[model samples]
Target: MERKYFDCLIQAIDLINDGIHIVDRSGKIVYYNAAAKRLDEIDVDKAIGRHILEVYPSLTFDTSTLIKVLNTGNPIFNIEQNFINYKGDKISTINSTLPIIYNNKIVGAMEVSRNITEVRVLSEKIINLQRELYETNNTSVEKIKKPKAHYTFIDIIGQSKEMLKLKTLGLKAAMSDSPVMVCGNTGTGKELFVQSIHNSSNRKNKPFIAQNCAALPSNLLESILFGSVKGSFTGAENRPGLFELANNGTLFLDEINSMPLELQAKLLRVLQDGRIRRVGSSNTIDVDVRIISAINIDLNEVIESKQLRQDLFYRLNVITLIIPDLSKRKEDISILIDYFIKKYNDKCKKFFNGVSKEVLDIFMDYSWPGNVRELEHAIESAISLYDGDIIREEHLPFQFKNFHPTKNFTLDTNVIQPLNTAVEKVEKEIITSALEQTDYNISKAAKIINVPRQTLQYKIKKLDIPFK
Candidate 1:
């Protein structure tokens, strides 16, 4: 490489946010970037040219990702490593180590590491705080009277056929101790159903803990769910995870599809036998906890993509409840709007009657990709902006204003159609609207409309609708 180009590459590497540590074939550190210096809390001059074990004495040749890659001439990606640096500060990082190969011979090894120590510490603190709060609340008689789950079946506002059926099924599922899986699009009130089930179940009085699997990385999530024992890894402490905290209660794991496959296997093991072993602990503890997991995508597709494990799906999916999209159940839109209007009226201290006919028409014609949550937000936004007795089109959000109805049906009194014809026309209109909102993507449109992709495809072909 040219001198100028090599210097430019070095400067660019230093500019990256992730720590870059490059070592020679002999396991001697050759280059350390600025990020590496900051992450390791070591001077660049002190790190460069030093042996990898010299700087990070906690790591051995067998354990060090960089040395292992150099020895095996193989790449290791997204592996979490916890070690105590030479400064005696314990640090955690997710590293991707790759061998530098030139002309079929391994020349060196480079490891790009992202510092997650702060994130792990913050997560642990949050868990500890939650434990403290739970203990305090349990000790006080007055605080113990508080409800773990505030919502119930009565809290669900929809009256559409799909929603009514879902509520009925939910009540039945709540009667049993079986695992239930709630699947729906984002903002479709999956948590509402989960909470309602908990409140209606025998474990209503016990803790109703919920965690978003997508919120944390695999290692942190594993610790959070299964607890951790001291000396398990660097900086680990003896702590109870959600499984123990929510004992004799319900543990709702949202976005279960985002959980790592290996973690999912552990979860499946716990579900199979009501036994959980804390992270780094060999002894198993028996816990009676109901699992209610939620996913916001197609289960079949996720299983096919290997994002979700098939066996875990079968285990948790003993009773599956699919939440319909807002667009699919337009019959409930008016009632939901009325409900939100009254809610905001009391909240904003305004005596707003309702939305205008124009606004309602626009809402009815619009496809709500964000589902019921989006509708509530839109109503809240309009109410906050409008001081009038009724909400007008001008008070609505920009998206509502920009939306143009692309329906194939028309209100023609002169041309009367049969019931089946009218139903087909409406179905085509709804499918088309969803498709347009999703930019002609069939799979996404199917999800938005709460229909199977194959069914949507068949409908598209049968209706002679144009799709990409």
Candidate 2:
């Protein structure tokens, strides 16, 4: 290529967020962008013209994607590769390598790699957190202080038809020992459902532990789930994992989709045999722990994305509960508002009697992406901000004050639809329009529509609203 064209190409590739690496047919590094250098921890001046294997000693001709593509004249798309650099620092990446052919002759290979080192680090930290949360000695369980479960089915606030159906299913599931999976958007009271089930289950008196899977990584998560032996690794002590700690009780895994795929396979094994093998132990121990898992996203989407293992999903999904969005249960919003007003009234020592009609209309029209959690926060915000007995529109958050309906739809006069059907259609259209306006930014869209972000998120999930 010409010098200006080459420079232009370099600048264009440099603009990309992911690493770009290119090598000649001879496996000599020809191009390495700044992103590639940063991701691979290599110097651009030194890497260009050097052999691929020379720069990354950990990779061989057989293992290197660039070399494989160059020799085979075949592309390797979206494959995860892990290697250590010359400095012995481990790097993980998802790479797409393609052969650069000229005149039907393989001339070189180009690789696009995205670094996932932070994900690995995050997972490791999560494992450590799990160990701390479920700390236990080999002989006895560690006494980490945990709050007692205060809310049961009675505490589950909504009484809408959908809510009633969900509660009925939850109560029935609580009677059994099978794994349960609860799916809903954020702030949909997933923990409340899990707590209610635990409180109602036969294992209510026993330990009822809950942990968010996103908080830890796979290796540490594994050690925390299935106890670790003293010599499992350096500083590894005889610690009982969550499974052992919650034996004959309930273990609630929140955001279960966040658990690593490989670790999920192990979880499936444990569920199958009612047995758990410590991180580095040979013997298997039996633990009759009822598992309850929750996910903020659609389970099908998670499974398709390979975040949640299919078999494990099926196991946990033997009994599944899909929580309704706040929009679908709008009837409960007034009740919830009243309940929260009383709640914050006592906590903040205020005498707020109710919300103004204008505020109520805004609440009804708003799409709560954050669901109940968001609603509670909105009420609390208004209560804390206002001194008067009534919560006026001015006391509401800026999101509500600046709220604007994105669109208005009119049903064809020639066609008549049922009142309920027509109302649902309008609701769906309004939400869909807002999502498009904000490019599907739940928080922004929620604010635009004067509802909590979680409530809006729940509506999206419940209404099957799709966005990129």
Candidate 3:
């Protein structure tokens, strides 16, 4: 009894967190642990002192795995096997094998395993969320206001051909005193280009001011651009306008096409004559401010519609620079992807291995309507949703399945078909079928039509199609 007690105490010294097992030279299981037989419903006492292969004769179970690690003097990790249970169902498990060394002699080896079935299931969910986020941001990328930053010309990234072309035009425009007009799709970094021009010009040291003409009321905009004398209507205070502050520098106007028609006439005079009159003041202020205006919408169309003054359009459009959309610049996507990934990773204080090839392939496929701004947010969201050390296909957001930028260069198939008089035509046939399916409720009918509610209402009014 005392001898058996001493043996148990000696064996207890070799116990470890990881499961341990010992086999004799003849391959007999002399000792094993409760943890070793954890997967099976077998009794640990019965599992002990049995032939290793005969003990757990499950499918794909290898007796030689531990022997191999023992002989190699190295550890084997993450070996996968579908172990058939007593009821004959496969259970996923990952095993780690390590050699046991005793006084410079190879004894036996032990194996440890962990179940990863739950983790695989969770990864599927994270991938789906990643896709949903990408789709949600795609439609609203431009409408959201970006966080204000103190970035200047140097902060603008890229030396790509498209950006360099804009830079050359900007440099030339900045050298001259002509009013500059920058045209681009919304969120194409128009402000960055404007600041670049200002930084390159001789007026680099002076104050550079920027404002969106479309974002403010006309009365407030007038005071902001042309200054306001004391007692100039409500919130009256003596203050310098953008023209005064930007004297010897540049004043950048964003969405200039949205500037009210009445204000455009006043802006035209300021451009024609380098003089501006303060509100409620008779004296004209002599300011040498350079003018730079940006518009996503074509000002010529606004001029034709009489929404903008023709004279003001011509004056501001003297030197025009059109920024190509992100879809047009496919070569820059990879560089920009890495840039934003690194940016957000540092800002969020998370570590993510680079995106998998599958994810990169999807990114290359998407048509970016919202331009660079859209791409940046998509990358940020992907990184936030990624689970593993690396971002994979599951890590990427959706819309990539159908996204093709090169295909977007061609004619858009989703184009609205003009009014169809006959019910036999495609548009008419589809709409009538949708309306019939919806039972003729206009609200429900418009959703069934897959067209905008406002558009469907206009079509109904135009075609005299009755809907309850």
Sort by TM-score, top down from the best = 1, 2, 3
Candidate 1 Cα RMSD (Å): 4.7
How many residue pairs clash in each candidate at the backbone level? 0, 14, 1
Off by over 4 Å in 2: 60-63, 68-74, 86-88, 138-155, 199-289, 295-314, 342-351, 365-369, 384-387, 402-468
| C-alpha RMSD in Å of predicted model 3 compared with the true structure | 28.8
Q: Who wins the lDDT comparison?
A: 1
Report per-prediction Cα RMSD to one decimal.
4.7, 8.1, 28.8
Question: Would you list the C-alpha lDDT of every candidate in the order shown?
Answer: 0.87, 0.82, 0.65
Model 1 Cα lDDT, one tens digit per residue, 1-468 = 999999999999989999999999888999999999988999988888889999998888877999999989889988888899867888999989999999999999999999999988877787887676555465466324357898999999888889999999999999999999999999889999999999999888888888889846678889998899998877788999989888888999999999988899999899889999988999999999999999999878878888888899899899999999898899999999999999999999887888888888878877788889999999999888779899988888876765555555665668889988887888888888878766777877787677999999999999988876
True lDDT of residue 86, candidate 1? 68
What 10-residue stretch in candidate 2 is worst by lDDT?
141-150
Preferred candidate (TM-score higher): 1 or 3:
1
Cα deviation of 293, candidate 1, in Å: 0.6
lDDT of 1 at 181: 96
Model 3 over residues 1-468: C-alpha lDDT tens digits? 699998897477346433456665344576666555555556767877775666646531233455556557787765543344565544445567776678977676667765543443343243343234222355575322222224555666667797777777778887887878888888788888887777777767665667777644455567667867775542245655677756766778888888877788888888878899987789998888888888886656767777667778888888988888776777788778778878988887777757777667656754465789988877787777765566666555463433322221232358755444333254444555456544565665565445788887677676655555
Give per-residue lDDT, candidate 2, residue 403.
Answer: 59
